[model samples]
Target: METLKIIKIGGKIINDTVALQQFIEDLSKLKGLKILVHGGGNLASETSKQLGIKIEKVDGRRLTDQKTLDVVTMVYAGKLNKTIVAALQAKGCNSLGLTGADGNLIQSYKRPVTSIDYGFVGDIIQVNTSLIEILLKEEIVPVFCALTHDKQGQLLNTNADTIASELAVALASSFSVELYYCFEKKGVLSDMTNDNSVIETLDLEAYHTLFQQGKIADGMLPKLDNCFNALNNKVFKVCIGNPKMIVDSNSIYTTLQL
Candidate 1:
């Protein structure tokens, strides 16, 4: 089977012009089929503020009300997605920007209200693997934004990490998929304040210990969950690290294994 790399980039990397340019160049050089998933939460938050939409969060997860949803949809599906696709194109990589609503690439439903009503938030239910496979076979790189839609015609704010993991899992039967979570940090840290305290390798046992000890929390909590999910579902490899680690063989980073 051919190898497929599904990399999800977020945090400060998305907003950094120089870093993103370098990332695109490196990605263009990667061999085999690849997919890029990106999150622009910081950009979305700033856009919401500019549009006078109050950003709400509970446990560091966005509360996507109607107005905030509109802002994110425009910022994520529109601006950031196209910017990355254009950059990839400039690097001679034929790339297509997409959202869940585009060609029904991803299907999800609104997150049901429980304690807090996260208005337009979505939990993904399915990924269009056939469409993704066709694109891969055609050598057309699909760049995905953090947006999903109900088959009923409503776009919902979806988490990019989940999107990457789900895509990796869904395609594992046909491809040797490797999922990557790249961000500002070097890797999963033992000390959040110290960037040098990177965990060399992380297995489920270590993850549970650190998690129980509260070493991982907030944004990283869900991210780690996505990592394990992909690995358990037969993704060839899962790594969390600096963006450079994806293309750098010697770079120090966290590797997740079952």
Candidate 2:
């Protein structure tokens, strides 16, 4: 079995171009990792705000209106995506930039509208891993943006965490892979404020307790959900931590246990 790793870099880290460049340098030295999924939410939101577009959030998830979606696509798929790809290439890593629209890599359905329409928001329906396999066979890392196409042929913005989870499940089923959800946090902390008290492992029961205690709120909620989802789908392992910690196994990071 070939070893593969699907890493999802958080938007906050992507916004810091220096961090992204360093991350690429670290990744280039890894021999067998096949793909990377990147988020551009922070950049997208910032760009949208500068362009006079209001960003709406529903339950901690971005509510992508038409204008917001356009901005997101431009940032996630256009600027940030290419920048990462270029950075990796300069570091001697063969890389390709893509979105769900390319090769119809990800298929999605529009989110149902209620009080306020999530104009161009989507829920991922499927991922075509064939294209990814081809890229991996040639030792090219596929850098994906969290944008998908709806059933009606319109591009819709999807959650980057969701994209990473779905891609992890797909790749794990097809090959041996480790999925890492890298973010700004050191790890999932037992006490939200203390980085030293990071929870090294979480099982389903512990996750439920944390959620019930309201400790898991805001962004961490969806990230935790994605972690469990990947575990349920039988990915080899899932880790949540800062990007720098991912390169050091001795460094503490939250590990999801089945």
How well is each residue in 1-258 modelled by candidate 1, as lDDT tens digits?
899999999958888989989999999888789999999858888888888878888877789888888888889988999988998999889999999889898999999999989899889999888988999999999999999999898999999999999999999999999898999899999998899999989999999999899898577888999999999899999999999988899999999988
Best by lDDT: 1
Query: Which digits, one per residue and each the tens of the lDDT, describe model 2 over residues 1-258?
Result: 677888898887887867877788888877786688988847888898899999887666678877887898889889989988998999999999998889989999888888877778888989899988999888899999888897567998888889989998887878877888998787887787776778889888998898888877567888888888988897888889988765776888888987
Q: Give the TM-scores of the predictions, in the order they appear.
A: 0.98, 0.95
- TM-score of structure candidate 1: 0.98
**What lDDT, from 0 to 1, does candidate 1 have?**
0.91
Best by TM-score: 1
Off by over 4 Å in 1: none
